[model samples]
Target: MKLGELLAIIRRDELDDESQPYLWSNAALIEYAEDAENEACRRASLLRDATTPAICRITLVAGTSEYDLDPRVIRLRRVRLTGNSTPLVPVTTAQLDEEHPGWEDETGEPSCYLTDWETGEIRVVPTPTAVGTLELQVVRLPLVALNDMEDTPEIHARFHRDLRHWIVKRAFSVLDSERQDKDRAKDAESRFALAFGDPLSARTEEWNARNLPSTHRDGSE
Candidate 1:
């Protein structure tokens, strides 16, 4: 939904109008909405793995082991040698250095990759002699700014409901604290926890249910 539409929803839900003693202006709500959107985007990316963009492929340059990654990459999921379908073994810089002391000097098809998330760079071991393709799959960074009221969020539409509740939670939190309405603040918190928190729990629970049986479940019975 558009930012304007979301603001209207928040106003109606909170019974916030000029007639009310607590004047929640559009500007204030918009600010809260932006904050909520940013928070929601972060949490969804971390908890839900929300980014599912197409895999990116870069041609390997002979004698080059380091490559600049896209700024929009939030998390690098996997690196593979394109057309081979086999994923590169991810290793730390220390591990790579220990395993292949002359990795920089070596020139062949890269069999491993090291992702430097902090630096936004990827390093390949053994470099490349012949032209080849390196494929990277990553969780994309979210677009946070909503300058135009008509501009919609970059967050997936499926999670918009949770995003809306989070916005309400933040707005009510500020409004309630300002008005000294503790009850209203608690209500907003409760609503947000129920809508957003439960789903997060469900994701964990579903993962455990699917994987725990084979890995961690007691089989003594």
Candidate 2:
């Protein structure tokens, strides 16, 4: 649905504030709509892009082991070099520290990478000596905001309408006297959660993102 249509629905049917001098302004509701859309993406893992240049492809710099990932990336799915066939392994930084001390000082084909959520960077093990590319499959949040009437949500249509529940919750939770409705806000929040369960944690998201099996016994063929 168009942002304009969703806004109209919220104002007319949901908020019942279609009268002049709307209880909630378009700007505030638009922000809430964005929040809802982001929440939907995170909670439902709705968008997985391996083709989007900004979201999926990472250019490599020779001798550089660590690089910043796009901020929208929520979970790293699979990462591989442009010249390689098998995807690189994902590992924890602590594991590298303990098992392969001075790993960052070495230079070779990086078989593993670790994501630093705090730094928003991924570090390749054993550093790279040659220029290359890291192709990534990732689960990401929406890159665009619903600030304009013409903007359409990137999530599936089935979940688009459900976003209204979150917008409604935010609308009622507004601090203004005319708009505040704590009881209704909580109810809407509950309904929204029921409709879209809680978002995945970092660990859970990582686990869900992985698809390749570790051995032939796992039936890769």
Alpha-carbon lDDT, every model: 0.61, 0.80
As a whole number from 0 to 100, the lDDT of residue 69 in candidate 2 is: 87
**Candidate 1: residue 188 Cα off by (Å):** 5.1
Give one digit per residue, the lDDT tens place, for model 2 in 1-221.
Answer: 99888989888878998887877888888899999998888777788788999888878788898899898987776778887777777776677889889887989988888777767888887788888889987789987778887888988887878888899999999888988999999888888887788756877755554332121222132
After TM-score superposition, what is the CA distance of residue 109 in candidate 2 from its true location, in Å?
1.0
Best by lDDT: 2
lDDT of 1 by residue, 80-151 (tens): 776765677666667757877866788788877766655667788878887887776555545446666787
**All candidates: TM-score:** 0.65, 0.89
Clash counts for all predictions: 0, 0
Candidate 2 local lDDT, residue 145 = 72
User: After superposing candidate 1, which stretches have Cα over 4 Å from the reference?
Assistant: 15-35, 46-55, 143-145, 169-221
TM-score of candidate 1 versus the correct structure, residues matched by position: 0.65
Q: What are the runs in model 2 whose C-alpha is more than 4 Å off? A: 199-221
Q: Model 2 compared with the native: what TM-score?
A: 0.89
The RMSD of every model to the true structure, in order and in angstroms, is: 7.6, 3.2
